[model samples]
Target chain A: METSTRVPNPFAKRVIVVDWGTTSLRCMLVEPDGEIARETESSRGIRFIADRAFEPELMNALSSWFDEFGNLPVIALGMITSRNGWIEVPYVRCPATASDLADGIIQRRLPNGADLYFLPGITDTTRQPFPDVMRGEETQILGFGLDKEATIVLPGTHSKWAKVGQNRILGFQTFVTGEIFALMSEHSFIAKAAAKSEGIDWESYDRGVRVAENATAGDAAFLTQLFSVRTGMLANELKSEEMQDYVSGLLIGLEFRQARDCGWMKAGDSVGIVGNDGLNDRYRRAAAIFDLVTVDGGEHAAIAGALEIFASVKARSDAA
Target chain B: METSTRVPNPFAKRVIVVDWGTTSLRCMLVEPDGEIARETESSRGIRFIADRAFEPELMNALSSWFDEFGNLPVIALGMITSRNGWIEVPYVRCPATASDLADGIIQRRLPNGADLYFLPGITDTTRQPFPDVMRGEETQILGFGLDKEATIVLPGTHSKWAKVGQNRILGFQTFVTGEIFALMSEHSFIAKAAAKSEGIDWESYDRGVRVAENATAGDAAFLTQLFSVRTGMLANELKSEEMQDYVSGLLIGLEFRQARDCGWMKAGDSVGIVGNDGLNDRYRRAAAIFDLVTVDGGEHAAIAGALEIFASVKARSDAA
Candidate 1:
């Protein structure tokens, strides 16, 4: 039952791991070996912090921690490192490793004597027609570990299907499934007709998945399959309560089918599902439908990743 | 230089054909032989008409016409016949002719002593997992003429790809490409980031089409390709001005690809692009890129179809 490799606090020297994104800010105090001590989150995301008041706002939120423990080194990831955030950090190209990511971190010293580091997102130049890129997710993938050679899926607004092998993060592709699902369910005529329901309609959802998986004529008949959501209702096959989940299942199922076509994964292969987007259960079920075994990734992957990458940066600097 | 089979008013007994949808109402007065005499459109679609004021609102809008024509028969189609609309008209099964549609009409007498006929939409029970249905497009396909055995593409919020032959609509499928495009460009992150620019960037749109057409991998990589619209921007391969048209081309292109996969039509085959959704030129261009010959459908196909079906109804009633 006690399986975690997290190190216990001895001297209790703390570091802050912040996953600051567009809509919210999540901060965690962790031990040197990545065991979280305390965590706090707020709506004071980059979007809300007007006139570059990020420092005062952040300090105000963590004033107690700073007062109790003095200045702690901070490592921040996510959209806060993008062009629109606190500082623009260049992306490290894949096939990347902890060291490669460490090399890409841009750092600054705060007025409170704390060192703040912003980790670089990653880009895949090998992608066809154009390079595919991901911010923040690269760190999450890093935190999920790269010892095993397997495909990993980090589901989000923009889901990433990545390959990890040889201690390096290989290339990945993005699927805008979540955003499409949101738009369709909230705005589309077929999906808008659904009466708000209390729970998931698993049967309807599975039916949608089945349609996507069995669409052998072209696994890419997404738009056509999308219309089936409406047709199903008109035919009295799908109830109004079932429309939302049905659309969800259909889009996610199509994502999996398309991912397989891109050689991301295949039937009988195991895939690691990372991220805590509340969509893991859906993806796991989808993976089961595709005959893919699910690998449980650690929930604190972001914290672990930031710590690992920052340590690598410190180690390289000390060695130099 | 002018050649039209449309009969000019020879004792023109006008019949009003109203395509009353969720967002707009389009009414056309046609001669007994189907030449459009006058047309009027308003935003008073089914969704806008409150408290069943449909009768009064319609009467008020067409009072002048009724005063002149002395109680003309009004044929109604589109969402106005749905469960949420004025009347719920059941859909006629596919492999149906004009007479079959005529037999399915649900008629009621208006307060003005005019017969109001609601034309039945068509349903393809053969569609997998559920029956596929269309409201107005079936009438348009009829207007396009069932004499020529050809595949017709009606572009709209929910576009329809229908097959016509042997004086009947054999079968058809629906693709929500327009809806998806609207959702993406208006709501999705990658698409919303594009600067609002006037006019279509044909080059960008064509590039998107090329991606869909030449996708060696799964053609249903729609979600994946949707991300490419964003990736193309991040990679500097596509300018902000080009994003809208590019996404438009990509979705429409994929629709054509999927339709071909579904055996709707093939390269070198002539396909008719019907409907006046302001998207025919784009569809025609996409059709050309797919090596299909574009057939020009009559501009007033709905009026013609409504008139023809009504005539069949009158004949059947007289025979009975």
Candidate 2:
């Protein structure tokens, strides 16, 4: 009876933050102090949730957490809020803050007596030819903080370079760097010659970064520079095992170069690198080479962003 | 016996030229006037010729030509001369002419007692980090003729930008534009969203070209500009149907931009578009947008190059 009884604390303020993406589902139960109390995850992402079975899938994934923590409010982000997900939430256009993001949050109720909030992604309408958009990264950027007028980079499958100032995300751009790197490394002519290895070759990587940083005319051409990977191997400059890291450095370096060209950051400026996609180190390394001082961004920025937006939305609802 | 009779003429001077590649084999019975007398092609490329069966496969592919032409010398090029091919021929270093290419030829006698010359690929040793090598493109560059001092672009999976002057290929750079386009359009996030269509949308393509042609400091960065393809769709500026051609234009245009950055061609300069990959039209269009005049490079440049290199080698052999 004692074990079965709900042991409640005066500081108990529990909530569920669900970061559901196209390929995976992850739910984190946050305690009063924003520490993750319990976590559950699965491959049953929005795409994998069969025939609009989002409710059943969600209930199943969070059943253990719910059984432990009671009916906690859930704040959802990522592809789960996209057109393909449970409900299509419209993007909140930038220059936006946590409150603005909260205002854009879409709400629904689950059968288990819990409120579900789907966070809206962000869009930069000023981008040329079309508006640039970010799904989960905008939340991470928000979590990274908006008080500082600095450039923030959230590197992932589609890397983002954003300008944050005045407690708002001013504008942003996406670079398909990770996607390109994955494609080239996994299924390309470049992939064929690479010797698989788990360790990073910093020397080869540094050489690749320098190639990208070359001020000589024609040396900065990215497409042409890619050929140097193969040529480097053939010329015995880069060994087979060094190919992947070298390519990684080259790509990340180019991202910095392009970001610089786009006025994201200058030579001496500091950049905030958000997100934990295992690419932050490479970005940091590249930033250092490009004369940038990289600032530490919180790893839990996504959760913080979700919590802030949800609280603001709940406040507005209570006020109304 | 009458059907087996060889039709001989006084002007029947001919040679067998084989463009043996990774996935296919193409043999041409070339007349003395540089015309193709008869041709045969098959899937029996170097890769398919198992267990060092290169001779048997070569004989089978050109048996009819061999029987009719009676011991004509064969000139082979492309991947057939690569390390994985039948015989690994070393690359001829730039700035090379037909004679230099001829000197690099690796000769072997076929079992049928006919001469076989494997034309070496060209390597630009002066290229940064490593030497840049091209197998068949060098021959095509040769075939495009060394009579004029002009920049020539050979478009394919690995497109080339070469400068020719004083009857030689001065130096060159390789842009993996075609390969990148193929990978992105076939196996990327861009591929999933694209609505497949039989016809190309030229207007969308031109818009993409203009995006790459952006004089704005940020517009010219290829990695950032690539994101526009996705953004263009999200903002309804570009439809899913137009994604392919638009991406194509953006990539090809970037190649030209990068080539220009490398000093391949200046504004208002005439450059030759060589090779017939069905992509020449797009390249020509891109060239026009960049203010470069497109000249017709010989369609039979590969064959012409092989023949000239063989002739030069044979002449040098005689003199020696």
Candidate 3:
């Protein structure tokens, strides 16, 4: 709640961006323009950092850059800002802009006198079943740029589909497609039948997407379609090696289908694909099936979004 | 495929009913009237039985039964009859009868001179995305009685929604709801938040069922709704122990909803709940939210169906 006075010309200096999660810590020393100056990472996730020890653990990763850069302002995102993180910051309810995210930031001074600003995740309270929440994807949505209205797809463990326009994330939903894919591949019955393959089998993957595309919502076919990955093998249509990609394809395809059903987009719409989840191409291919034009969110969308939020905080603080 | 002469009055004597799954073998000694005289189970699943040793494993489990009753006809179902099981009996495509399943039986003689009938699984080639298949559920539908046209739900790791009437399984679809529940409770993000409970938490369970029932298919709300389990915890709306049951309720409700979308049942229709999966009461509660009246399928639906098919095979073989 207590924010220190803003230092002048903050945009010219380096900023430390931390993506803290359950099992790992990643720190990015970035120029104002979003290019990485230096990076450090370790397994000292917030979960492993004992109570009241997060600052020290975080400093362990950020100290060298701090010593060299002379007290760079730190921006923490991801689960690091969650209730289980160093300090639990409440989520900024959408429709949120960079400035609104900035307003929701919790601030503290580091041991080295550097200001630490924890960016709050955003929630889409309008979502049915429950008010949907996302910790880090909002930044990716921002990083991808919000000037143009588009249904942005940030594919990850829990993929987010957001409607961004008018400089705010209007509302969003999470699909959990990737997590389901991982669960099926690692622990479900499909795990046994599917073999580890060398790379993504686009053919197998596209076939899965097509399967999702072919299914009508009336069929309530996602779960049933999932079973086909196994049956397809039994029917000699899908090879064991192909099962992995086929399943990935099927689930991702289902996400797109579900998103459409939720009224996220329709034919002839342009969708921006963002994030660094290594699944961009697959999503692009999936988009084509749904007749959506694609726009890349570019590299460093998260970093760009982070810096944008930081700049907004400084801009407002400087004015105040 | 080779079925020999049916010795007269096979069912009047004792029948050995075997439920052979991936990891266990269960056998029941049934009198002519479908009463289970004695039951025995062992972990000697076909997978653990080593090469050509299923017969030994079966003998180990049933040697005493054979000693007292002489050679009883062994009827096997489940994954034990799949490609990985002792014999891969092909699936009988639907709109199939008990007679069709009886006709599709692959017969072999045990070393004990008993006839072992591998019951063929049934597949609905009619399903979209891929042909839907079930190994043992069709028999449950038969056991539940095919005299009346009704929707029969067999809840298990992979639950099946089936239609039966006129002494035939009209068609059916499988929903991996139970499997997804297991996966979420044990391995997904929900696992850490959910604690093992002694019994079903009806309130939490019903809340989940209601959540699913409220969401229209167009909402594509299932995946988004699952995130609420975690968010609901964050919001302090759900307790740790309640997570398991709530998720169970949600998935099962979704299953019912999806089944309805697939034209399995309507708001006013009565559905038959079968199987011994220990979740019938919970399912009955879910069925009610959609205004569905439920009929109970008696204990040992699988066994009763098995007997019915065995009788059909015997009657046809005797006539031949």
Candidate 4:
């Protein structure tokens, strides 16, 4: 198995990588050695482009980036290929390696006759025997060099808690705790029952977590406990921010307990957080309650993962 | 004390009863003896008709019926008088008798010059430090003659479990369990993951009740249990109907357990169910798990309640 130290660049040799997300689209011009030359981003993510047919607009936006690279091979890894995006690629089962996504698909045609590829999302199957879906986060997990084995926590509206091993997603679970909290705080009757506040109250958050942790079979029956938030406000007992934090803690704490019970994560498992800074911090603090170690997953992981796929595609084209 | 028994004209002294709900509006023309003459219903409920705008449409709908009764005084109950309905009548604390609502608002003019009275909903302050809300069911409890000290269970989207004594609604609690179960089983992510079928599977429903009843802190993760619905479906060990029933049992069972913990009901206390037949049957089955006796809530509770209110108004007017 002699490997070539000098990788051959198949035609134009340059590679274009795109990280198309829910809110924005980012394209990177990469050199053969995995170094960034020029990076440009567009606001045309799946959300913006979802209402219209995606393929034409995507090809048009992507063409300019390729033209700058002199018609180089382009590879995309993100939500761009989701059901609601430019194309829909079926999710590949976990225990997958970087090589598995090396041969994905690009649904659009280019004028310069450039080769294109898209990475498939990851899925997991384990004890519960259900599947978990991930688009852009797959790139970050790959970038974390978690190609071997690790637990990754992707926090968002619908948080994804996953187990990764041997470059494969072993299993995962999704929790709507964030969305539930948001809806309840903003739209549900609980909002009226909760005391109005303006700042984060750590004490309320702690109290909420304790309540969630000790919630018995009938605890949910007392959802009217939400009314206490308002009563507390009227009585000048709980600050507004504390009420908000308490609500957040209740939702997050419930999610955390559920995740643990589902065996989504075990004690002593190394957990990596991939999300925005503020959310990551909150999650980190919450994770401390369970004594779990947290790792930073900056935007670099996404770029690296995209570049890895781009390089693989270029290498394959050259070999063919 | 001297009592005079007088029979009002069946046609000229007809009573108008209105049962306005979230999604529909219903009106009935009743003879002096409470016999139904003509009934009319419409899609104009609080969900569609704004609180301030309901009066006009209601008057228009009942114009012909009122003509048949030669301008009989209409008594409106149910949601029409709720905070979100035609008139925002204040809640009268429970342990309330039929006479309480009967003494509520009287003689208001609809836009069409029709005279009407709105029944006040019941509020249970005895549970205070915590209070609960009841709209149309207050009339039904009065109709069922449960006002003289008994427990009443109203099963629907927001199931109302109440304790009444001496014509007063003593204490009560509302469980959003039905609404939660519907949302999770039909619109939420769980619906997508689990199978959907018709009818209840006793085994799966029983299993759900057991889990909800006895799940330990370490074993009570909803996410994990939710996923099992899918796995059970895939494994051909559970039916779609079973999944729905299981979710229902879990939620309702949890509510029942919580209500018990909150001291809303005692172990030996009699329970009366008010609702349609199906809902009452479900409550009966669930209550049987706890060895509690269930009684019928009678079909005429809503109408009877309205009649009781009307009778009170008549007595007050005569006294004046």
Candidate 5:
């Protein structure tokens, strides 16, 4: 859905949405209305690109596209806009709109006669301890659509629990759930026993979710509940093959419980689950345990979001 | 302190208590009354003991002590009694006494003509999701003295919050607080940005504890709070050097909060902090944040516990 009744595709031109992050880069030829055509990806992420030679590396990666399509305007998102990336773009503070992000969009002309635009991330100043922030996720949340009021969960290494309403992103909080799960799965005592698991064991996974729900509802054993992944095995309740999914379920479940505690949702509230991190299914199941209705924000929200914001930027420039 | 009014040193012999865990081995030549005459530690924990060659490894690690003492009795605690170790001794259920541990001891004749005793770990069956278990800690708790009823917090890689009363360990729960902290410190994004810091920044650490205390006192954001180490840095509230201690305080603080949530502690209550993991100072600081009194369990709690349990075993067999 188009966020607000903004002028549609004000530039009426095709865009090459570049989702460049720390570890990988993906470029997509997206239509004005968010239809993605031929795409290419590489391991040449910002981290791998040395000496800040991002321009040449990007040019080389898109050399074929530039040759065929004649310098299509490029829109870069994700960590490419971070302090460590090609250019450090300032974050637009929430509650933010597509136009707000468009206003913050950094524009530069490419040597190949293409216009380059970098979208700024967003931050929540009201978050205690410090302002909570996200780079690519704000755009991803924007892609998730802001036509209706609801809680949107974009699950990833650093999962964001965001509030979207009134055509703006109200605020959001970050949960290091995935990173914790990955760390435990690879480097912890849980990792030692969970070795050689083939795939997700739904039964064990659901059991984990149940444990988290029970703990959340009754006792506050979030830390103790984490130890359950091991305790369950010692009790002959969880098998080695099931440990991974069990830990996965438990971590995601805790994320949901924590999110609820932070006032993002209640049992009866509907929440939109969006992200390309492949954790949506698990998150959907987790939402079920919390009595939350899941609204599917289709894949390609990043592409949709980038396109929409780019069109707004073009409209503003033309008006100027 | 002696756990109860038990007969002292029934065998009238000095002892060697071996705290062999997953990654290291600590052997102490302890006098009958728990005085450490000499000690040695090695990287040769259970994981490094190849081909089940634990006997040879121990002999080599303690060759000098054996040469000097001829044949002191050896008592094994920690992971050495688990399934992966030399012998799979079962865990004694909670509400266990020193005598129960003594009765569960598995004795073997070493090559040096010394009696080797293995103390069984303890498990709380009432812990939801599954039984919570702790190796070596039960003995340490015993060493902490069970005569007075009190809640003991043993901080470690897998910290144990145990209840002691009537000369028996009533029940306990395990929190992987230390493990999570280590994992985040060395592997997570927090580790990435937190480079080159020496010593604990007490002020930063206190701020982290405050964050956890506030989260516990008001809302639930354990996962979100973990991200504060990063957010605090991004906001310039927490300097890079302070990140480590801040995370340390936050993790231990969450452990306390979770323990209280699990009904193990409360404000105005005096809790004893016991363990060999060198985390008591931080735990004490965290306890203060929750309005709880901290009682130092001293450094040699493990040695005392092991000696006391060993003494009980000797008394039992002699009586039999």
Candidate 6:
């Protein structure tokens, strides 16, 4: 059924949203109503253009796209505004809202007179001992209209579990689970312990989760178990995939426990996943152990969030 | 003050002792008195010859070395006898002597009429429910005369802490400390935290040792502190070398604590290091914390171990 009327393309001027990530760059052209019109992407990520500043290369790439539709209003998110990116937008302490991000500095010039707005990353100060910072995902979280309280999990090389409240990032923690697993599997002696496997072994992974959850040895000491995987394999006790799954389960499970210990999420708290299908499934499975519900965090939410921030900025500018 | 000893003529019959490692090959021509007459080496190691049987490439390399001399009794050690090598000598459970290894197997006419004796790796049965194996180091341990009673620390990619008593390996445990440090420094996010320092920071290393010794986090979890190094550096709380030392100390210190926990060594135990100099020093410093005395595990010990094994084998063959 029809829910609401679509806003006229008052910004028929078109709003451009860019999700500049580590490995890929994605740009979406949106009408005033936040409906995607034309989308373009490239292999140009932070890694490819890291040696240079973000603007010229990004402008050159986007200029080609914008040549078709002249002088569009562009809003950029992600690592592009990081210290190494096109512009360094300072981190806004979390529990932040779209208004807070919309209030961040907007780069108005490309040295060539191209107007651009960069979103400031969010940091959660509620974490007493220290604070956690997030860049692009803040836009996505804001996009999710998670305007109220919720738990968000962004799984990747460094998986982040964050708590958001009232458009502000309450707090967050990062886990090097993916990076550790890759390192051990490819470089460490544990590689000797694992065989190439086609799929995950739930039992082994579950066992690993249990071990990680109940580990009495300190974290630094538990690394010794890495060798045990190989030893177990050599002894014919564990299959290869089981070994791999155990490794993954151990890491993810530990991260799960750590997040819980940090008081980031409760047993009944809802968790939202902002990642791909495989990672989402893994998080769901892990979160299920704690009986947590998860919501979808797809591209649409990110675009919605960016557009909301844009609308707020336009409103404030018009008011001023 | 002169000790009576047997001195073989420089031109006397020579025995070729082959030390084949994972990366390099070294052949030593020894006199009856166990002194080196000639030494030659090649870049051929197990990794380079992994696809080929150990005998042909090894025999070719030895023949080139022996082209200088004539036929000689050839004794080989190291990865040459691993499952992928020339021959796979099954492990002989420890409480074993040099004679046990020497008399284990002899691979004859290996691509040539060269009489080759393959050393059997040693294994420990003392650890209940499992056993550990060692291939090349058995000869070195024997050469050190450590068969009777002693504690040996063989540092490498996988450092082995072993206890020998009454001519048998009482027990041993493996610590992947070196490899873990390497992986953490090079591959893991911890590398981002560490200041790339060329030299060692003893103080920071010591501090890391203390932290690892008293680690409270679980194994994979303690890695979270790695970010603290970067944070600490950015916050001006620590220097680059200090970060390196901290990481190094944590890994080594954790290993030390684990070895101690495993009852691998006692406070008053004499620890003999059988590896390279740098690792030996690190181990010595770590051992110092526990008041354990350490001795040099030099090339002489390895040679002596090989020669001792040879003598034991000769004696056993004579008995047979």
**lDDT per residue (tens digit) for residues A130-170 in model 1:** 77889898877877787779799999889999999898998
For each candidate in turn, the TM-score is 0.94, 0.93, 0.94, 0.64, 0.94, 0.73
TM-score of chain B of each: 0.95, 0.92, 0.93, 0.83, 0.94, 0.84
Local error of candidate 2 at residue B267 (angstroms): 3.1
* Model 5: reference contacts kept, as a fraction: 0.76
RMSD of 3: 4.8
lDDT of 4 by residue, A188-289 (tens): 543445666665667778676655556554334344444444434544565655777877776676676667666666656667877652566667666666
On DockQ, the candidate that comes out on top is 5
**Candidate 2 regions with alpha-carbon error over 4 angstroms:** A1-12, A314-320, B1-12, B314-320
Name the lDDT of candidate 4. Answer: 0.65
Shares of reference contacts reproduced by the candidates, in order, are: 0.68, 0.84, 0.63, 0.18, 0.76, 0.19
lDDT of 6 by residue, A1-320 (tens): 11122233335467788888767888888876668888888989886885675777778767865788777777888878876577778887666766778778567765545578888888655432234466787766666555567788887777777777765666676676787778888877556557667766778777766655554433323445555565555556667667788777767776777676556576777888776426666677777776677776764666766766776777888899
Question: How accurate locally is residue A309 in candidate 3, as Cα lDDT from 0 to 100?
Answer: 83
Q: lDDT tens digits, residues A1-320, model 5?
A: 22332223445667787899888999988665556767998889898998999999988888888898788889899999988899989989999999999989898888898989998999999887688989988877777787688899999999999999899999989998989988988999855788556667888788788788777432547878888878878888888888899889888888887787778888999898888778988999999999998888778778778766866766778899
Chain A TM-score for predicted structure 4? 0.77
Query: Clashing pairs in model 1?
Result: A220-B220
lDDT score at residue A318, model 2, on the 0-100 scale: 74
- For all the models shown, what interface RMSD does each have? 2.3, 1.5, 1.9, 5.7, 2.0, 5.3
Instruction: Tell me model 2's lDDT, rounded to 2 decimals.
Output: 0.81
Chain A TM-score values, per prediction: 0.94, 0.93, 0.93, 0.77, 0.94, 0.84
Write down the DockQ of candidate 6. Answer: 0.17
What candidate 3 gets wrong by more than 4 Å, as runs, is: A1-10, B1-10, B317-320
Which lDDT tens digits does candidate 3 get at residues B1-320? 11111222347888888898877788988877667889988787666777857778887888899999899888889888888888889999998888999889999999979988899999988777667788877777777787778888898887888888887888888888877887898899755779899967899999888888888654545667778788788878888989888888888878887788788888999888887768888888898888998888877878878888877877888899
What lDDT does candidate 1 reach at residue B21?
A: 92
Candidate 2 chain A lowest-lDDT run of ten? A1-10
